[model samples]
Target: MIQYFRFLIISLLFVSCTDETATAEFAKGADVSWLPQMEATGYEFKDEEGNKADVLQLLKDRGMNSVRLRVFVNPSSDPRSGHCSQEETVDLALRAKEMGMDVMINFHYSDSWADPGKQHKPEAWEDLSFKELKEKVYEHTFEVVSAVKAGGVTPKWVQVGNEIPGGMLWPEGSTDNWDQLGQLLNAGYEATKAVDDNIQVIIHVDEGDNNEKFVHFYDNASEQQVKYDIIGLSYYPYWVEKDYTETIDNLAFNLKDMVKRYDKDVMIVEVGGLYDQVENTKNLLEATIKAVRDVPDNRGLGVMYWEPQGEKSWSGYSLSAWQEDGTPSPALDAFKN
Candidate 1:
């Protein structure tokens, strides 16, 4: 009888430790949304040691505990640009899950890149009425999330829309039309909850250093009663400010203030630096990570490098952390510390 009691206590302690460890895992993520497409084009990824390796494994070895993938409603048929469809996202997400990495599903809501400058409504959703558009947002969000769940992996985070600093499903859901934007975002949020009540739903916006923009956006969201769990920001020094130090300082200040103002967790969902400037990139990443870690009450989750594997030859995207031999740049070392 004493032996049985001892075994029960030990088992309970083990379970409790496991739960705490899982909860304490900070998100170190990479947005490899183009990995599948890149691999299809015969691109191979190498580790820092210059040895060929599985991209997902390479990232995991680099201290990346999570991955973010974007999904489009209906993208171009071209294999290169069209692979982010619902099914494709599910497959990629499943792959990440199998590797013991948390997954963040970013819904673009459009067929192509949806950012602050252009929030193009999906081609199929262009003709829908305001009411119909709201319904479409909910349906599409629910369908994609459901498919992801059905694929044997439930994403740890679900971003309702990508880089909607101004708003999404534009003209109708633009920032100026706060009411409609809130309604659309709420629809997406509700759909996500319906699929997985525990999943953290994020609302992403570009310009992490701009406290004013965040304040304006969240204030409006509060007024409209838009429900969400995380505030995702895109902080690119090259685009936001010419001085890297200034950008870092501004971002750190805003991150702290944003959490206090809105009382919500925050994350740098997108960030990148010039691949050629390896040292600078490393410094930028280190500073960014430190700033995020300093957020009060651990509300600052972590930073995600956007498309660090994007080779210029294949994607024409200049911002990458890969060398000519396809190995990750040394700048990635910042993630270790």
Candidate 2:
């Protein structure tokens, strides 16, 4: 009996240690979902030495160890506006992985952008009943995740929806109908796990500083038994039109509260500052990373710049960290050390 108990104890310890090792690595990187379209349209990427190279290599050389790619449902081929379709997303994921970086797959569930302001159900899904809608959600999620995994890299994180503060899929899947919204979210979770049970699922919301928003959504999620493994947040000072210093403390507080209250890991999955304010943006990035690292128990998993490589000149996104002359802003150096 003593020998049998010893064997069992060793087995249990091995299992526990393995789980910890699986998630022990910290992720820091950017989302360059627009790279394919950007390169195709002649946006040259140069490294610090002014030598043109793959943008992923430049990013990896600058303290990034992971990559986040956004996947849209059925996207148009518009070079500037659209084209994050599954094929594009999968190709990017493979490139990042080939560069020895971990991957995070973000699902928008829309043909275009999906945020708090808009969560348009895919045009194909607009007419389906709520029950059918859930099925489509599962089918779509499973197909995409399976394709990504089959492409030689299993994503470490998969966001069910991007910045979904108002709930996803609208009308029926809106926050106004928690029961149906919960079901829709669960469809995503179930389908994701069906593909790879180990991939962590994230329920992302914008406004990391607003503990009230997290409490409200997560509270209802808990009540509805929404199956998710992480709380993903997006913090943008530019959008709020305020200095990050104003809410940095609140963001830190929310990170601490989330881990303890939700009993799950958290990640500042999206964060970026304006390109013009290099110093302020660098300080904000450093402070934001420090806040996540300060979370007790290592529940803070990662920080990803929304689109650091999407330079303003080419992408017209003012918050990018790339210079018009094809170089990264010093702000990205915050990830170092």
Candidate 3:
């Protein structure tokens, strides 16, 4: 009887330790880059029960512990695209910080969207030479990070460029020119560390399920010795048309392998679901969260829903978690886990 009791006690202690370790590690987050703009246009968000609530507070109540905001350098003259300028980004970051949520600042490095297909340099930087543009990247990163710190909110993470699968700063720093791209990335990384050494730097790219793409991008970045802490991926189900089960399994496998290969943490820094497909979207979120959480040795940091509050009329963005009435979709419940 004493031997059996000892075994039981050992099992109980193991379970307790496992629970505590799991609790200490995961983060639930959302990218609400359009929050300020949506609120500016009189959009209101309500809790699941229909009570009017502050969006940030509602998110916190729903178990989201982090928020990601994107910043553009000298945004376009158009009002819609101009609101995410450095000052506005700092203001938003302050708001998120006030709510006791960690903040991640995504630098697009352009006056507009900077993705794989379009990484247009800010108009101001268009005139600079290749060498000069590298300086600009460093200067921009340091300035924005400095401003965020000045606003009394030191971001927990900083993304050097948004979805740079092909690369950023156009032909000058495109993937075709891996050497220049590496220099620009290193510049951003160094600048971010200059402001705050503790801030985790991320290199974001789209197509989370494409393992080869990730391997290719990181292999080049590694070869060029680009410094970064996290591998951020944008995984949209609509973009990856494989069988649902296959897709999730592939993503999970890649996530684990990437962590082992890079020896760095990983995050689904950006993801979105169709507004009308609440149930399906919920499944996707649950699967994605699980995949990230399943990375061995706690290397899976978290997943962030991209623009969960963006409604059709607000920004014409289709992949929001908000219904037409401004109430959060059932898809958001996945974050509650």
Which lDDT tens digits does candidate 2 get at residues 301-336? 889998999999888898899997898899999988
The alpha-carbon lDDT assigned to residue 314 of candidate 1 equals: 77
Best model per lDDT: 2
Ranking by lDDT: 2, 1, 3
- For residues 211-313, could you state the per-residue lDDT of candidate 1 as single tens digits? 8888899999999999999999998988855757877888999999988888899999998988889999989999899999999777899889998888777
Scored by lDDT, model 3 comes in at 0.89
Scanning candidate 2 in windows of ten residues, the lowest lDDT window is 79-88
Task: Give the Å error, residue 147, model 3.
Answer: 0.9
Candidate 3 similarity to native, TM-score = 0.91
The per-prediction tally of clashing pairs is 0, 0, 0
Any idea what lDDT model 2 has? Answer: 0.91
- Model 2 ranges off by over 4 Å: 1-23
Error of 1 at 330 (Å): 0.8
